[model samples]
Target: MKKQALSLLLALSLMSVPALAKENSADNFVRGKTYAGQFSDLPEGHTFYENVAALYEYGLSVGQADGTYGLTAPMTVGQAVIFAGRIRSLYRTGDPEAGPAAFTAAAIGLKDAQRVYAPYLWYLQAEGVLDKALDEQLANVATRAQMAHVLANLLPETVLPPVNDSLITQAYASRRRITDVTEYTPYYNDILKLYRCGISVGSDETGSFLPDSPITRGAAAAMLTRMVDPSLRLTPDWHLPELYSAEGAAYEDLVTAGTYIAAPETAADYDQAVRYMLSQGENTLSLKYDQDFTVSSAQEALNNALLAVKRHCEQGYNNASCSYNAAGTMILKFSSIAGDRTEEYRSETLSAAIAVHDALWQQGTITPASTQREIAWAYYQWIAANCTYDDAGDNTSVSHLPYSLFHNGKAVCDGYTGAYNLLLKLEGIDCYALPNATHIWTVATLDGETVHIDATWGDQGNTGTKQYFAMTPEQSYSLHPWPKENELPQ
Candidate 1:
């Protein structure tokens, strides 16, 4: 049968092309390397590797002089026609080169003599594979969508007819890469045909068919292999690595350790630093600041550190006081008892703050029924009922600490604001100490509004009334004025 097919070519006055491959003893066909160095550029494990190899083995295609298969380079109309005709010839007579002679003979009679694809174009016209009206596109690149339509028309009924649209649609939808094609996609039926015949699989596992994407020569070679033998399969598994910023790992480590560094170089580092401080436990944060850091970054980090300290107290860290510098050098005590002469006195102070917070939580002061404003008011009343105004106060007096208000039931304005902020913070209502030169007060978020609450003033004869409860910034200014009202949260 092969002899008769070869004889038919001679009868057409066709000249024989010399065999390209040479018999060699160099062991040139290495498994990981190219076949006889023909496609040296084709890397192993590529999506089209096996299929292109099969096409080369079947004598349907050859690589360029530089040994590149050009898998991603666009396939011209000439190349597409040659591939289609070669597959047809291979199927009919088991001779892959059988169609080239007929194509060459037909090219000489064409008016467009300068056309490189004229022979393949005329051959396709004679076989009724394509019409002469498409001559203008002879030099244009073949598209994936166009390939789908052409494959549907040329392949056998058994290969082309049984493409289950429903199965293809289900498969297409399951893949993550394909975004353009839907059940309602244009050229929908032809796409189903290509999928059914195994001539095309959407780009990788991502489900991107890229239907309109221009087809490449090496890709065409693989597609041709599938068309000739529908049993051949090409499934691509491509994974792109996840990208991360330079600070991502460091930030993650800080969060995992539950340790805060007050000076971090970047914004990401600053956030992780805050999160580390917030996470519950015995937090021994380094109070040292980097002298070579930006002021805005340093301030933001310091502010967060302070908030973390308050959150620490809110989370029941009464006995443990986190100490840090107030300015660049002057150290100040935050949250814990102040002016304790000995360890025995300091231990007693911690016990008092915990006892007060536990008593409120047990009383359901922060229950679902109570609003943040209502709970805050209750805290103000608690402070008044328990604590007395400490008039004869020194700057380092224990009366200035939250510990004094809870432990001794005697406090200055600092102690009133500190104790009030601590209790309100414990309930998760945002509260902070607002300070002036001589006095301190509390600013809290209540009923979704930032307001001022002066528990000291509310302590009229230690009565603890609603007269000073939940006052707006403007309202509080009338009785007690502060210069930096615009600096607070709106």
Candidate 2:
């Protein structure tokens, strides 16, 4: 095997401390190996031919009748199951360091049964890894994301570490292509786990996981190799900075934007610049600089700060993008709402703010003597009672915005959070919009700690209890996990 130069420190930090049963010095699992083979199509220089050959040598696969490895063919779910069994057998025979464990029966059913792959399918079913119903076309091609799900689940229980142990899910979730994965998908976390486990680093440089794309035969072999080999993948080079710190945030911007900037005259100046940009809200900002203010660093810092501030202003539905020109002028544009931030939207938002304040005040839900819990609970109940959930308007219009809740008296999660958060801020409560994998919710500081307050889930047709309101991290994480747990209060 050829030596693959990579760093593991960052990789280790991104994942949980893996408990490998024993250290195997065998190079079978290591990457960068080459082999001459009978396969006619997979040439020596083909992208993943080495992996395909490795799997073949390991007895995980047999070449086609034509002696060609279908490197670009879409892998079938049944074939994936067979691969899992072959891999388990390889570990059992070659390593000899670990003992076999019992497999639990799967809870879900499988439809079509190919006799050749039946034993492997039954093994996966007993392991509980194949716990969901499969389609009738057992030979149908599987998607790249589906492959991720199956491969991640097939990881040896002993080799697998706890999921999201490094709290990197939020960082992974920020990639531009994540929107490609539909909301509430079954394999959502499994796909993410594939990256965290060092089995895959996504499809491209932009962190485009491209989960729905079909898995190629060669790609499947490479993925299978990486799944068992801990040292085969590269560490993620980027992460979100300490959002509350100006210097940290500035550094993050510089890294992501890949732009150089002249440092501020002093650290104090940089801090002031960041704080000021955040306070500017949704306006085009112009920053004048002294003759010595080259602002090479602050330029990128300013852009990053604007992004964070925009998140706060829009309650985490951050659609605002900003950039600085050579003239030192900073422009902020919100393309998501575009013309929708018209006179109509602003007037309705303002009216909703006033209405929420008046109602809460009149009801005595928030007062100098009221506890944060009481204040938050009252607001959650108020929104639940006043607004009916608009399931169809989820992503159609501005129905998720604050104005929709007041005007239409209907909303999705975003509107429930936006309206409630605005009301809390009016009464001087510190609240923030929190991000789940594909959804958003509200969190607030109350009674010396932060608590989750999801009005959308709490509103159970006006007859439901406030069970979801004021939930602790433990209570809400399973359903609405805050990817950045440390940022939220313990």
Candidate 3:
């Protein structure tokens, strides 16, 4: 047999601890020897094969007499204590068989069948690894939480260093780390200690550690191997999906545009109701009114809401219709431009929008101190330079929303106007979408003056010229007609 080199700490501790246990002990313990036998069940490609092999290689486990590893068998509390004792003994003395002889089965008051675990339990208790209060539960099956408690302190922090502690702390602060494990949970700190040490990554993407669930032998083997081998540790992939922050100026824009509704009384209320429906990635909304409304008024409100949805909301809907009943419930339906939106699809779209917004902000060199006019010009130039006029005469759904301008790099009049309006609102600048019979553009309050900007025309031949930037009403009307009612001062 080849002699394996031990750490200096273990070599030093060997002089203080007692001699190895009897050679005929039930554990059949061996030191400085690697296991050569293979389990019939743990073949190559098995998920637990590598960890179980590591377990055998370190003399932590020898499987069953039947020559098969009971991978799915529930790990008992006694077995957990035994594994913890073995790990501690190996780390402290370089041999799993050595422990203090002052502790024994009779000394711990173990009477009958539980006496089999007495040596390991007494060793752990003597070494401060096992609390005396946990002695009664040694006969039952161990839960994941119990397993964490048993294994958490088996090795010191020097050996089991916390690698993912910061990430875990952040996720826990956000309440996104583990859904089931809370501060009130038993042994919660112990479980988190294991997680920080990379011994266990929760069972799911959400980091859901079903603490009360029984742990199987295969799972135990995986955690046990990671306890000693830092290379086998896993980093958790538990990041939450990003969504538009309610604290951002964009959310205030949504609120101001009447996208969030509590009641449907005023025009803004109805508009916000429709906007809310569209933002939810849904095509239908049933708005219940608190006050009585005439059929024409309800129809007019629906039209206004639809217009607001088209202008303010980034989602694209091709067509819409509404029906009002005597009961004051208006059922509004819309045909989405992007068909069949799932939660995942919505998350992906929002993520893309955020990415585009961040990239544009960085590349445009727009700062908080930048004048509204300068910011507006930056947006105008970036859009004109990057996006092309969608020459396709057919009204595609994307062409009606900013998604076309930012994602596809091409859009018609409304897409350009919508993108501009949204970007201005996100910067806390006041802006509006101005639409004529066949054209749409932007009117913004810049430098205490109202200015007309047409990015679509500015990007003629994909050239971002300043042909229509900072134009007064008089200057813009010659090229694009402005409605008298929606007119603004120069």
Candidate 4:
């Protein structure tokens, strides 16, 4: 079947040679004249019109003889190699037509069926721009991945510098860059190099490269133009809809609040302000008091504000410090539990965590008839079954926050306690996170009795156990030491 298709493709290529030659003849090859507008199919409003115009103006492409650009036509590997070879030649020499004076398929040891593209194949292979493995697939329609391999090394980094390298690196680290491309994909590094050079963004908003899909003429034109003209390359501003919509009624109100606080007088006001900032994924905030205060009074206010933040905000704020500026305004700087993550990354992580929380809530079998103890046990089991302990011991990880447990499925005692407390609060059960010198656990009021639930310890290998659920203070303290008296609620 493949042989039949290749034979048909070769016959078609042979039949189209006369038309292609006429289109590329000296009579039609006018320097600096845009041939893209001449094509009846490619209008100014077309998405690839500018790129095709650039391709034509640079003599890299000439449209079909039928006055159409064949925008959606699948580009063959032969055409791709020819385009790549032309681009290399044009970049090296002032003229696009500059290449080996004479070459043939027989001369390069290629099959006679590839005679139409033999010169281009020989030129590209001699220049080290084309891989010899592609010789067998010259008649096949080039996939996007194959096109990337063909065009990647046409120009050196001097002309095609990787402008979006850091953004691509970050996107890959988060596993959100290209949906279809992975480390195991063929020519994976070449595909990424195209993105870093801004030669291609992707076929969709999610940055899906569609590696198996055939490349279209318009898409090929866009990529070819970008290779020669750096200005035409794209800088990906990844629009992650899933992350944005993951907030899902969990923190919508808090995330939508204003960041500025006009007059924060009481501890409650300060607490609300801090919550607003954290919800908006801010790491720094300036709180100006309506009245003046001495250094000692400001220090007290800062201490109170920190306490309020710790009590009301639990979005993985590890620590915070405040300083009084010359104008007596208090500037607070917070260190996030998701260390070194950008504000956008932190916001997305929080949204993803909220999505997990909402999903678990919807999946739970909780009802009005369910007892408080049963509800607590259900949450404890769910946390234990779903999340594993973070044994990596990375201090900068988000293991200290609920996000690690909800999104990453691995966290420390602090993450387990935070997540458990969050779910219990959603069930209208009063719960608080109790922290000791080294570990943290949840203290919840179940059936009019206060009991400790340590999900971290409850998670024993494959599934969660009730060994630490609904334990008395004596039982819990036997395995895990009790928190300081000052840290415990009266």
Best by lDDT: 4
Per-residue alpha-carbon lDDT of candidate 2 for residues 182-285, written as tens digits (9 for 90 to 100): 45665878777776676666665545677777788788888876666654544554443321112211111211121122333343343344334434432333
Q: For candidate 3, write residues 273-316 as lDDT tens digits.
A: 76566545466777766557678867776766666555443344
| Among all candidates shown, the one with the greatest TM-score | 3
Give the local distance difference test score of model 1: 0.56
Model 3 misplacement above 4 A:
1-31, 38-46, 62-69, 93-100, 105-108, 118-134, 164-192, 201-213, 234-352, 356-490
Task: Report per-prediction Cα RMSD to one decimal.
Answer: 19.2, 21.1, 13.2, 19.7
- For model 2, state the Cα shift of residue 95 in Å: 11
* Reference-based TM-score of each model: 0.38, 0.43, 0.48, 0.47
- Candidate 3 lDDT: 0.67
What tens digits encode model 4's per-residue C-alpha lDDT throughout 1-25?
A: 5465355333222111112233213
- Would you list the C-alpha lDDT of every candidate in the order shown? 0.56, 0.56, 0.67, 0.68
Candidate 4 clash pair list = none
Q: How displaced is residue 371 in candidate 4, in Å?
A: 45
